[model samples]
Target: MARVKRMERVVALTKQLVDHPYQLFSFTYFCKKFEVAKSTLSEDVLAVRAGLEAYDLGRVETLAGAAGGVRFIPCHSEKANEEFLTELALQLAEPERILSGGMIYMTDLLFKPQLVMRLGEIIAQRLRHLEPEYIMTVETRGIPLAVFVARAFNIPVVMARRVGQITEGSTVSINYVSGSSKQIQTMALPKRALPSSARVLVIDDFMKAGGTARGMAELAEEVGAKVVGKAFFIATQEPEKKMIDDYTALFVLKDIDTENRKIDISPL
Candidate 1:
């Protein structure tokens, strides 16, 4: 193989750090692989960090000492986050996106890999400082978002099911009131899913009254895990009394005019 140029090496190193979010890499590995001096490698790392920050791509951090190394923390500036959400809200506000029962047709948006990846990055950045041990979400719609966030944190994804499954052994089930319907519902999780006293971050695709989010939190309690934070892709403004009060959301469903087939949404 031909020798790689300095610029090429810097680009390659940046990709590796960005792809392996939150994972540390020692300078020794890069120095040996690129056959460069420690001082040269350090300069390359600084250049990569500067580029990421200037372009609002993310952040690169370094540590010094025996256990110290460099790691990439996924994040975008607050202004950029707001701009992205504003554009997304416009697409979501189309009259055709409205459905009966005050529901917005977001299935197409939710499944888009590009959009989901960005959403995960923003949510991960907001909750990353908490140092959550695992990412949890209810089964089905929220699974994709949870998986993306788990990748960002280099952690595992824990799921809760509305109905218990025979394959999952020794399950713990709990009943919570659905905030919208005011009816009791059951949610279950496997006993071995999480360790005792784990710090969990909960992510959901959408929130109406936050009953499902609350139920997942209760289920986490059953396994002795503490909920560090909760986040949502979208949330409705109706049903004034939400089961869960403290949470973060990307979009707020301000109003839905069923008669006129119109919708209003805003970024938070």
Candidate 2:
């Protein structure tokens, strides 16, 4: 291959790092791919990192030594994160989004690949320090969010199902009260899905009474997985007391006025 120019190399490198976030690539691999010297590749990586930081897109971290390389971490600057969340809150506050049961219809938003990926990036940035081995979530709407977060971390996603499957083989099941309906519900996971003492980051699309998240935490415990953190896309304020104690949420649904069809939401 012909030698790649500095600008072209920088652009290509940025795309490669962003596409494979949190995965390390050796310097030798890049040197060969671009037909450039180690010094030239170093300059190229630095330039890409600088551009990403300036734009608040994310960050590129370099590791030294023979086993070292570059890794991309998906995180925005503090100011950028706040601004983006604020805009998202406004979009979610539209009255049309309010449903009859004090719930905001958000399935459409969660299903959008780009939007969910961005939300996942923000959550991954917040919880990356936990060094979770696996991203876990209950089956359904939260699956997309969890998958994107797993992608951001370069890890795998483990899902707990409401109904047990024969294909999953022997499973561990737990019964918990539904936060909203106050009805008993069972959630299960494959016995071999996670190893003992695996660190888990629990994610969900929404949090109301927190029963669902709490149940997931309990399920993780049964499998000997430590629950490092719990995160939600949106959490409601109606149930001030939640089943789970510690958790983070991107947006707060302050009020859903069914009578007036008005919705109030804010970034946390």
C-alpha lDDT of all candidate models, in order: 0.90, 0.91
How far does residue 152 in candidate 1 sit from its true spot (Å)? 2.4
Worst 10 residues of 2 by lDDT: 1-10
Task: Encode model 2's per-residue lDDT on 163-188: one tens digit a residue.
Answer: 99999999999999999999999999
lDDT of 2 at 215: 97
Give residue 207's error in model 1 in angstroms: 1.1
Clashing pairs for predicted structure model 2, backbone only: none
Using lDDT as the measure, the top candidate is 2
Off by over 4 Å in 1: none
Poorest lDDT segment (10 consecutive residues) of candidate 1:
236-245
**Candidate 1 lDDT, 1-268, residue by residue in tens:** 4788999999989999999999899989888888889999999999999999999899999999988889898999999998998999999998999877788888898888888888888888888778999999998888888888888888899999999999999899999998878899999999999998999999999999999999999999889999998999998887767889789988889899988877889997
